[model samples]
Target: MHPCLEQADILELIFKEIYYRPTGSHTEKDLLALALTCQRFKEPALDTLWDTQLTFGPLIKTLGISDAEKESENDAFDRDVRVILTNDSYEPSPEALRRFSSYARRIRRISHVPDARSSILEEMNTELAVLVKLSSWVRSETPGPMFPNLQHLGFIGTLSWTSIPCLIILLESKITTFSMYWGNLDPKESEVLIGLLGRLGLSIEFLELTPLSYIRTPIDPNKPSIFSEMPFPITLSWIIPLLKELRSLSCGSISLNQLALQNLASRCTFYKLQSANTSDDLLEAISDPTADILSPFATLQHLELFEDNFRDFIKLVDYMQPLALQTLILHHTAPPTASTLADLLHSFSEGQHIASLRQFSIKHTVSEFETINSVNMDIVFDGLTLSPLLSFPNLLIVEIDTPCGFDLRDADIRAMAKAWPQLRRLQLGSKIGWGLPPSVTLVGISELLIHCPRLEDFVVPFGARTDPPPITNSTPIKKNMTYLYVGNGRAPGDGSEQMALARFLKHVFPDLCGVGGEWMYEYGLEEEQLDWAAVISLIKTQC
Candidate 1:
């Protein structure tokens, strides 16, 4: 035997290098050949090959066929290629189980998402039944879990009473990360799913559950939907005790009510929480006269709430202070009232989150239910509306994407740039409004680059009407900036305006690569888009 083969670590490293290569590299065939070479190479080679299993088909085939099943001519190759399960009740003998255990123990990750493009799991229809029988046999013979070293498990399919047990069996204390996506289910099935996850306890750390919806009946415009995105209410309230060590959680459309928020804050040490729909439960709870003032989300660092109108957010800041909160993202479903917007912005200072907060994003767009004109007339974010955030020293990224007009002037842009010298990305609005002219101009952008040298990706709406200031010897050349989004800013189609603006950008933003804007054809502004494209071309050639 080679001396390198005697050292298990060195041999494993060589096998891993081959295994981690890109697909269609023939790493599997080569590893199988090395496993059949000698006893020394077999264990390490097989270990590398079985580290990650995309499907349970390979494990099911390890049980072998029954006596009633007839073997085909290409049965050996067929078995190697796909799972051939003739009998779900085929009991694997002690010797067969020993073979299965060798490979099963080597598995570290199993992600069996059904109907995944170009995956073996697409063929897994009735084959999961064999796993139930196999798990039972393994438990009876072996003292520990089947996949002892398995740390990550993901399943994206239907979860019934029978399949829930399969998942429960898979959930050992060693697993840390889990992801599951399932279609609509009844309340009972949801209970079973929650119960299954409850077993993980403190062992699990990262959890993401996306509840997919499927409609069986036709839509009726007259009546309201019983199934509003999420079919059944799946709360994380009961599972709070189990997920004490959870660091990140994403509950798609599954709301975390006020009590759940309190429990999570008091019990769990999670830092990140995201929900598609943040209901008014928190607001209602805090407003209750009988409710006691308790500290909520003490350890939370990142929070993203979708489909909210800042009413709950306003109440949250009023009730509790986010001592450790860093990132706050609010995607409003409805246009925020001027008072609500002012209150929400000013609450950051009251909460003492000015120093800790780094990234702040507030986004809202006009839907079919509302028009651009309504959004424009309702609220216009100006210097005063955004002035409260000027105290955040460590703020790196600020994105306020409203599809309406912004009333921010040149002074406001310069004030922001001067406030956060460490600013990297400053995105203002979507630039989709009409008839409302922009207040900030090209000179404001020049001043922004001068103050914030670290600013890279900048998106803002500014009037391209006035000519930019002439470049001088003392002008600060911002070489770090690469992309600038012109939003809904219209540019002059005249050659003189385009050349001068292009020249100014080239002198100030030396590293500027591309200039982008919103789709102009939707608003019949093809000439405006063409003018910006001309600026990009001039920046490259004029320099």
Candidate 2:
């Protein structure tokens, strides 16, 4: 046991690379091996080894099985290795206790993913009981708060909604970052959830609460219903004031009622606020002139409006004057006209809010099937010079869509390029509705390449000219141009013209990488379509 290896800092630095390596396969294997090298390495290496665990199986293995004991194989969390741990439980031996104490005490994060099998309830219960018991045993004096070193904890969605109360109490005030993705929380869990929010509200710096899954996922009827007892709305008032330390918060389908929105607006402080659907109230409440303004969320740096109810957009935009707002995302609903998009960009043009914005996206909601073929955006690109938007001199990403149709031509694109020459990621145009694609040809695209040298990722409507350009060595290498996902499908699928256009693009932007939509390859006079590979092939060959 050398003094050099005794340093936890050095060992942790050495072990972290293996522990957090990208590939999932036992990243901790080397750390475990290091733990065996010497007693000094044993403590630090074991600490790094058990810090994050996929299953408690590794910890359960530390408690040796007795002759009479047999672990249940009912639920196979990891089918590769089956030991459900419910069969015949045994008390921890002195040697096992010493070993468990050595490692378990060093745990900082626990990712408890219960089996998704039919017996998930039983499996989660069994696992929770073990954690409750083990933590109690490890910290003898305390009945709960098992791992004093634990600061981050996560629970899988497979558990029954009934077990949330117990889970919350088990966490107590020790953990500062918590994530629970339980899909649906019944009325009973809501009561526990409210209390849990209160108890840990002050301590939590980062929180993720997922009580509901995506809008498309069908509800499990056999499971307890979320609406059974008129589910309690989770108001921000319950959290915001208390959680002065809160920096990041994410809630899925949890209602942020008016009272909560008021508190947030009035207090007007936080780093990030992201939630789905609840912004209906937050937007309305924050927009209210009489809502006790510190300019209602002026301190908000990042705001993601995935609101299901996007009724008053004009009003929403009126109140979106965040002093430090950097990234803004609006999901679902009618696409904003170029004029409306200009205003949002204009918000950054003036005030102390100047020049800090980097990414702004407005994606039509995915859940709305009715809008699949409906007209959402019909814009006259000539009217939307959006020159004021160019005031954002350091802009990095801009996606203002016209899902219905946009009358964008070559001159309009050249004007756009003149406005924003620093954009790295640009996603314009739309694919959902029935309309003629915006009239942007290779000439306009050529201007974009010539102007924005740093352009890397792009998704825009593209069309080839009736008379294509003659290739020459004058084309500057748009080497930074990489990914392309065309919103509008192929413009001219005609064999020679389209092929020539592809060849021209690959020539000009010698490193031009990909084209989106249905891909087809030229076969003599005709072309055979192979949507995926064919389009990618167009972007590779150097001019």
TM-score result, candidate 2: 0.69
Scored by CA lDDT, what does every candidate get?
0.67, 0.57
lDDT of 1: 0.67
TM-score of 1: 0.67
* Total backbone collisions, model 1: 0
Tens-place lDDT digits, model 1, residues 1-543: 112113456568777877888887866679887656646666776777777777665665555542213554235324433433344444568877876776689888888755333234443334454465577677777768888998888776655555665676688637888877644555556555765676554578888776312112211112322434444443455575567677777665566656656555554466877765453655565455555536556677887776455777776666656566799877665657656677788876777788888999877632334433233555666778788889888899998866655788899999999998889988887645322577788778878877888887778778886888778885778877787777667777888988888888888888888866665325566777788888889889876
**TM-score (all chains, Cα) for each model:** 0.67, 0.69
Candidate 1 weakest ten by summed lDDT: 212-221
RMSD of each: 9.0, 8.7
Quote the positional error of residue 243 for candidate 2 in Å. Answer: 3.5
- In lDDT terms, which candidate is top? 1
Residue pairs that clash (backbone atoms under 3 angstroms), model 1: none
